[model samples]
Target: MILLQINQVARLFGAEVLFENMQLEIQSQSRIGLVGRNGAGKSTLLKIIAGIESPDKGTLTKTKNLSIGYLAQNSGLNSDTTVWNEMLDAFTAVRQMESRLRELETLISTQEIDSPEGQRVLKEYDQLQHTFVEQNGYSYENEIRSILHGFQFDATFYQQKVQDLSGGQRTRLALAKMLLQKPELLILDEPTNHLDIQTLAWLENYLQNYQGALLIVSHDRYFLDKVVTEIYEIARHKMMHYKGNYSRYLTLKEEQLALDWKAFEKQQGQINKLEDFVARNLARASTTKRAQSRRKQLEKMERMERPQGAEKSANILFKIDKPSGNVVLQLEDGEIGYDKHVLAKNITLDIRRKDAIALVGPNGIGKSTLLKSILKEIPLLKGTLHYGTNVSLGYYDQGQQKLQPQKTILKELWDEHPTTPEVEIRSVLGSFLFSGEDVEKTIGLLSGGEKARVALAKLAMNHENFLILDEPTNHLDIDSKEVLENALIDFEGTILFVSHDRYFINRIATKVIELSPEKSTLYLGDYDYYMEKKQEEAELLALLEQDQVKEKSVSAGKQSFQQTKEQQKIIRQLQRKIGQLEENLEQIEEEVSQLELQMTQPDNLNNHFALIELQTTIDEKTIQQETLYEEWEKASLELEQLDS
Candidate 1:
């Protein structure tokens, strides 16, 4: 059940080899995570597998009728249609089936009943219906709704044109459509780029149950651990496999590197001993034969190459020249936004010295806006912000807006602090992995990760006691992110930053502030602790809701019992009244019968007055009987209604 197999795969860019002789197999339902540093050709390898790019030398085999869906980093949907319509396009086959079924239905209606033509049309319609159902045509819209909701695209966005959406929104839509496509093999490159923590969690759960094979390229370690079962590490121009999640892979890789280094050291020692013996004994006549033997052995031995270590990561260090006051920053009832529109209100924060606070919220909820407001780059709609005495601030824009596009990497750092010597500047740049010609490269030409490094190098040079950063780990690789986290953890300055990297936050943050459109809530610990507290709050809310429901049920039960009792009492009264009416009716009937018999007698017939009196009495009895019968009917009807 192998979906794809790549053998002897090699890719080259000019004279530089990105990777060579790489081997990999993607079996049915495999969950693989492909990880490497930036510019390591992880995306290129995905393109090769997806047939978007061909390898310089390799053989790629796939099972017949294999299907693949590839989503590149920042890839977006360019459709002009509305979001709902674009999603419906994923079910083109089902839509076609529906069309054919409709046509067949019309044809059947026009033909004679029970005729051969009509029967043929009906049969075709039945077949089409079966196919539609098998393809999930009936619930396809529901499926789309579920995916849209998971991606945070609500009903308000359904009718919005795709062309009007942002790049991140478009990327989300692309992913949503691909999920609906349900290809046999799915490949995603940095799919978590635009997703928040909630959506990321939802996607992790969704992919865990996905029936198709998945090959994901992402720097999100937490995401890889949750979704992928295997790791394919592209390092040192070769592919290596590990049979576990990202965390497990790190442990295994460290162990393997240690073993490799030991073996290499042992081989080097043996070679050195042999060479020394040959050098000392070659000229001596008695040991000449032994020396020749040793020389031959040395030449025939297989030499072990030194094991390559992990790729070089940026060396980030944050230091402050002076200490800040105990209260670094205080905001009272702060409101942040642009123009008159407020993104968040009722925000109050007290940041102390040496505190590392992580700001987290859904996308577009204004975490970045809050940072800008604190920096005074944007006017606050309301409230006041106070900075402590002697607090020098350093800001790192995740967008890298502070770095001039026209300046070179070296100049970007040099211009910030011209007093520093050229050699010292170069040394600082080298620490950030910018060396030789790399320092000459312009900021505009650099990749996201490279730009981030240059920005960090500048931040390092600034001796500020307080740092405010926004999405600082956006494009950083896992190794670089770890280095940055370590530096921030060691920094003596107070920090307030916004980030969606849960792992980074968990490592470096001492406090977390969750922002919403309405207000902000503070948590007294790291990302894990914050999540635990939020989960507890949710459980408590659920219990409260359950209690409310139980209370309502109990109250309703009491009300129903009282109503039933009242109805029973009314029913009993009606039954007694009906019995009394029936007895009165019997008495009236007997009196009437006696009156008729007396009237028939000869004596009574002779006297007109007596006859009249008898007739009047009979009439009175008849009227009474009619009244009793009406009353009994009414009582019986009421009793029956109560019983019912």
Candidate 2:
């Protein structure tokens, strides 16, 4: 079924037309990706479909009772409530039903058992219970917990107030709640903005099982390739649909453009031939009729418009004035971070000339801090970092913090190279997409992407032998990123950069360094190779944990057969404690099951107070069960030790 349809949609920004005559239909379970360059009105189109904005000229139709969940770029949840409570609020209907069910249960307990009022209450409760089960009331908390875990928001974070959360955390919370709401259509704009590689992987897995339709706007080509089955590209003030993932779309689009260009050129050749014949023969008396006929035919011919090629992307080239030593950089047991606290320690790295190394880690794991330490902008907490001979470093700060806000784009580059002529500086700036009056614009007035380009322009002028880039691809558009990637891939100088853009990393990185608080691990390959190794390591770790558990069990079994007589009393006590813990576990498990069943009933689902009470009870029981299991394990271990 078509969940939504947009016909002849037109949007205008003053006199500039963003898009026109756009038509789209979103069918049930469709996985559609919307891709376009920045300022192409992709987000605006999403807002229009989401009912957050109205199209200037268009008709939008939706299936009856269709629900859409839209998450705009960098959108954060605004709530004073605790994180857990905010998520719970997404299922207000379920909570309301739970409340009513509880109230019905209370009334049933008070009324005569054989009375019609009591019987009606019981029936109502049964109906509500069934509805609650269908709505997943019994497993909602577990679902929330699982999603929170996937987002790296643990149990401790659930108690944190949403108002106190960081912007990125709030954005994650918004996404989490939207997923919990389970709307028919989920529209996400740049959903991968703040995600680390691990969380991105988790989200991909989660969405693969999602039941609803998905419409995503993202610059992450890798993400789009994984999740989207169809692509809609907004270009040249028009929307073109392609039936496949991003990679397939690229191939199909290229072929289509090639065919279009060929047909256009062919038509142009025929038109020129007709025009030439008409011009020469029209003046001749013998050929006047033929000339007139040719002219008429030319006039009647349908002309094909020239096929529009890919838009121009910024040209980036990283060149070094001189070559550095083979050993470009060395870090010996280095510790990086603040003076008082070390973010990562025992790190050792040896970078060679012309090697492109990508540093990757989870958010807040100090990838940026390590970069700063390497640049010596900040004091290293410990150990030593040495630069090889003749290594002139050029740093690209992702935040563009080094750029002076008061300076114009032109001045920013010229000031760094006082001897360079103004024309030369302007030429370099123009290469980075700053042209004419754009050079006069103050750095403060520039957008993040503009600032990034300005920084690149400055870096280009430095003529450094080595480049240390921090989140270099953060604000770059897809095309710009690809250009930069290609530039770096071709550059002879060494590179050490931190980035979460897997596509860029894959394209440019020759080696990967995975950072953690404890240490850093090196993988001698690109991003994909690094990921494969990480997966293998994870599987091995899981197997090790399983082996440890089995070892403990085996130790217990052996000890049971070889117990000393003097240890008999202690073993008996341990066994008694274990039995008690097992009993408590069974009781808690039974109570949890019963509570879940009760939560599914109509009366319990409708009773708000009862629902809250039941949820609280379940939470307590779960905690208690976990505690008992730990105690039971400890007792069993102790019993085995005594026997041995």
Candidate 3:
């Protein structure tokens, strides 16, 4: 079913039209990704769809009783209530049903079993219990725990007041609450903000299995690829939809643009030929009729508009003034933190002359703290740090604290490079898309993206040999991020940066350093390679444990070893069975998803018999999946017990 239909939607800001003739239909389980360049009114369109803001000239028709949960970009939860209480609010109706069930129980206990009143109370209890189970009242608290844990909120945080949490934590809590609500339609605007790689992965997995439709606006390409199956791009004050994930969307978009250009060129050639013929023959007496016919053809022709070009992107290039020593940076037994509070210790890192390393860890695990420690902004708690000769370090602060708030954008870069010519400074700023009057804007008044560009402009001017960046992609849109990634990839300098953007890390990093309180592990390749290595290590470790268990059984004697071997054999069989069941269940789910998508098509919607057939197939697949799930769960438990 179409949960929402937006027809000819138009939004405006003052005299400027953001988007017009925007049409979209969200199905009951659509997974849509909204993407565009910064300031292209993607968020404005989301607000219009979410019904948070009205469109200047359009209408939104929603399904009756449709429930929507909207989380604006960086919109944190603000409440005096504790975290547990805030989450509980999402389950008020279920909780109310539980209360009534208790009341029914009480009435049943006080009356005779043979009486009509007693039987009525029992029926009421049974009905409420059924609804309670369907609504997940029994498992809701556990669901809350699982979601909060995924967001890195532990049991200890349950009692904490929302006001007491940090801004980022509050934003996470808001998202957590939305997930708990499980609305029919979930509309998120930049929901990935303030999330670490680990949290982003968890969120992607959660959203993949989410029942409701998702309309997400995220610059995280990897997340979008994993979560959303459709892409809606808003560019040049228009919205266009493409079927597929982010990577597929890119491919389709490029092909479309190429095709559009070809058609436009073909039409332009025809138009040129027609005009030339009309001009040459219109004045000639011998071809006057033909010329008039050509003119008429030209007047009636539906001219093809010129194909639009790629949107403007920031031009970022990192240059080194001179070559640095082979060893760009070295940290030995580093203990980094604020004063005596150490966040991570026993950290040892050796950064080479041209290696781009990505520092990764969970949020608040001290990725930024380590960067600050290396810069000597804060003293290293318990170790030595060194920079090699001829290494000029340029830092990009994620918070933009390095910028002079009172200074203009022009002055911000010019002051840093006082010897450079005024025209040269303006030219560089213009490359970053700060042209004309935009250069006069104060740093404090500029948006996050603008400040990021200013920072990049400053970094470019320094021509540093070694760059230490902290979440450098925080405020950049997708286009700007790709530009920055290309720049960093082409840079000759050594780079050590902290970023939660997996796509960015995959693009630019030659190595990855994972931080933990216990120790640091170094991976020799990018983010994807790091994950692969981690999985291999985990499997290896599990195998080692199994071997150790076998050795222990051998130590017990030959008869015991035989019994242990048999048990292990059974465990392996059970594991294989569970794996087969899981694979079958996955196939069934995919089939059901395809069937549902088919049901949403215009042709199938108009064909009543087709819709019923598709839905019936989906229902059968769902039932089969539930049975497989039960078998998988039972086998998994047996395997777990045997392994234990």
lDDT of 3 by residue, 370-394 (tens): 9988888989889888888898989
True-structure lDDT of candidate 1: 0.88
Please give the lDDT score at residue 105 for candidate 1. 52
The list of candidate 1 runs beyond 4 A from truth reads 103-130, 273-297, 549-644
| Model 2 TM | 0.86
Ten-residue segment with the worst summed lDDT in candidate 1? 548-557
TM-score, each model?
0.82, 0.86, 0.84
Q: Model 2: how far is 399 from its true place, Å? A: 0.9
Provide the lDDT at 373 for model 2: 85
Model 2 scores worst on lDDT over the 10 consecutive residues at 549-558
Write the residue-wise lDDT of candidate 2 on 1-644 in tens digits: 89999999999989989999888989998999998888888999999999999999989999999999999999999999999999999889998987886687677768874689877876787678678768987567768878998999976688899999999999999999999999999999999989999999999899878999999998888888899999998998999999999999999999999999999999999999999999999999999999999999998998998898889888888888899999999999988888668788879899999899999999998898888888788888998889899999999998898999999998888888899999988888878888899999999988888999999988988889899999888877777888888888888899999988898888999999999887889999999999999889889878975564323222333445435443665765786788788888889879989988787677876664576577679868878876786687688778766644
- Winning model by TM-score: 2
Over 4 Å off, model 3: 110-123, 546-644
- Number of clashes in model 2? 22
lDDT of 1 by residue, 236-308 (tens): 8899999999999999999999999999999999899989999999999999999999999999998988898
Ranking by TM-score: 2, 3, 1
